[model samples]
Target: MKKYFLIIVIFVVISLLGFSIIPKNPFYNINWSIMSALIIGLAMLAFFWNFEKQGVSSKEVALIATMTTLAAVSRVPFAIIMSFQPMTFIVMITGYVFGVQTGFMVGALAALVSNFFLGQGPWTPWQMFCWGMAGVISALLGNKKKEFAFTKFIILAACWGFIHGWTMNLWHWVSFVFPLTLKTFLATYIASFPFDTLHSLGNVIFSLLFGKTFYTILQRFKNKIIVVPLDNNADIV
Candidate 1:
C-alpha cells in the first residue's frame, strides 16, 4: 500500500513539475506531455502490480488486457471521423463491470496503444488522462449487482465528451498560448464544441446500444473466473 501511495505521489509530482517546466526555458524543448503520460502510465502499472498482490486472478488480467486491446482496436473503424469512436464506451463499460481500477487501466492503455496507429504527440497523455478519469467516473456511478442505467450512461458519456475536449484544449492553451489567459482557453473550447458534441453523441449511441451487452459479457467472464472451492472429501472419494 505504501508503494502504491508512493507511485501516486510520484505521478502527481512529475505531472506538476512537467507542466511547470513546459513553458519555461531549457525545459521548453522537452515534451512534457509525453513525459507526464509515461509517468502516469508507470504509476498505473504499479497499481496493477499491487492489484496482483491483492489477489487479482490471472483471468482478471487476461480480461483487462483483452478489453484494452478491444478498446484500442475499436477506434480503427472510426478513424475518419474525428473523436467519433467507441473506445470511451468500451472503457466505461469495463469500469462499470470491473470497477474503477480496471476501468482506469483499460482507459489509459487504450489511448496509449491506439496512438501507435493514430499517432502520438502532446495529446496522447491528455487523452489517457481524460479517458482514464472518464472510466473512473463511470465506475463510481455503477452498481455492482444491478445493470447500469442507460440514461445515466448517456449523461455521463456526454459529460466526458466535453471534459475530454476541454482537457485536450488545455494542452494547446499551455503549449501555444502565452500566459494562459481564460479568454484564450474559452476560445479553444468553444472552437472544439462541435467536435466534442459529436463525440458525446457517439458515446451516447454506443452506450445505449452496446453498453449492457458488454457488461453482460464481462459478468459472464467474472462468473467463470470465480474460484469455486472443492468439497474436502471429494478427492478422496
Candidate 2:
C-alpha cells in the first residue's frame, strides 16, 4: 500500500514539475534535467526502502541486480532498431516472475543504466517511469500463479508497447508541443505511430519466442530463494 501510494505521488510530482506549476523558480530554470533525475532517483530509493522493510535477502538483491543488468545490456545490441528492443519484454518477464517491487526496480534501473550509452536527457525519467509501469502491470497480471497463460502476457506486452509510447508521447507533447490542443496532441501521437507499432511488434515477437523460457528460469531461481532448510538436530513433533 505504501509503495503504491508512493508511485502515485511520484507521478503527480513529476507531472507537476514538468508543467512548471511553481512558476519562474530560478533553480528549475537553471537545470530541470538534474532536478528530474534527482526526483526520480529518490522515488527509486523509496521503493528500495520498501524492499528493505520487507527484509529482502542478499540473494534477492543479487538476483535483482543481475536482472537489471541483463535488461539494460540487452538494449545495446539492438540500438540501431527504431523503437524496437527486447528490454521491455525482459523487464516484464522479470516482474512477472519476481513480483511488483522487484519488477519496478528492474524496469526503472534498466532505463537509467541503458541511457548511459544511449544518451540521457529530460527523457530519462519518463522512460524509467514508463518501463517501471510495464513491470508493475506485468507483475500484477501474472505473479500470483505458478503458471501463466502465455497468450495473455503476449497480448499485454503488445498493448504495453503502445502504452509506453503514448506515455512518452505525453511527455513530449507536454514539454514541447505548443497550445496543448487536441489537434497538436493527435498530431504528436500520429507522428509517433510507426515507431510505436514497431515497439509493439518487437514485444510480441520477444514474448512469443522467449517469454516462457525466461519465466521458468527466473521462477526456478525464485523458488530456490524461498526454500528453508530444517535443522538436522531437531526432532519431529
Candidate 3:
C-alpha cells in the first residue's frame, strides 16, 4: 500500500507540474494530466520492479500494459469531445476482473496517463478520485447477476458511468476551477446531462460487445492469478 501511495504522490507531483503551466478551462488544457501519469506511472511501475525487471511474469506485465493501452486509446475520442465513449468501461472491467484495489488503481492511473494529451487541469485530482470510485463501486455492487452471463455486470458498469459523470459534474460545479465556488461554476449539468446519459448508454453497449471477449481472454490466465469472484451473491454468473 505504501508503494502505491508513493506512486500516487509522484503522480500528483507530475500532475501539479503540468497543471501549473496550463491555462484555466478544459478547452486550453489538452491532456497534460494523462501525460504526467505516463511519466509517473512508468517510473512507479519501474520502482515496483526495483528497477530490475526480474520476478515479474511477462503475463502480469502484459495485463497492465494491455489495460493501460485500452484505457488510453478508448479515451482519445472523449478528449476531442467527439463521442460518448465511457472510459469507465475499462476501469470497471479492471475492478471486476481483479477486485477493488486493482480496479481503482487502473482507473486512476489510466486517467493520469491519458492526461498527457489532455493537459493537466485543476480537475485532475478530482477526476482521478471520481473514476477511481467507479471501480470501487463495481466491487461493492459485487458479481450479482440479475440476468444470464454478464447482463447484470454490464448494467452495473453502465450505472457506474452515470454515477461517475453526475458526480464529476457536481464536483465541477463546486470546484469549477480548483479553488472553486458555487458562483464561478458554469452549472453546465443541464447541457452535460445528455452527455452523461450517452456515456452510460455507451458503457452498456460497449461492455455487451467486448466484455465476453475480455472474459474469455481472462479465463485463459485465470488460474495463474487470484481471480475475483462474481459468484452466488449475484443473479448472473
Choose the strongest candidate by lDDT.
Answer: 2
TM-score per prediction, in order, is 0.79, 0.81, 0.61
lDDT of each: 0.79, 0.84, 0.64
Clash number for every model? 0, 0, 23
Least accurate stretch of 10 residues (summed lDDT) in model 2?
27-36
Could you tell me the TM-score of candidate 1?
A: 0.79
Q: What is the per-residue lDDT of model 3 for residues 1-237, given as tens digits with 9 covering 90 to 100?
A: 557756776776667666656788453444434544444445444334442333545666576667766786789767666326657777776667655555566676677777777778766666677666676677565554332257767878767666777767765554334434444444556666677788788889878888877766654554576445577547664
The number of the candidate with the highest TM-score is: 2
Model 1, which residues run further than 4 Å from truth? 3-53, 143-145, 228-237
Candidate 1 residue-wise lDDT, 72-181, digit = tens: 99997798998899999999888877888888888988988999998998677678877887788888988564765778778888888888888777777766766557
Stretch of 10 with least lDDT, candidate 3: 45-54
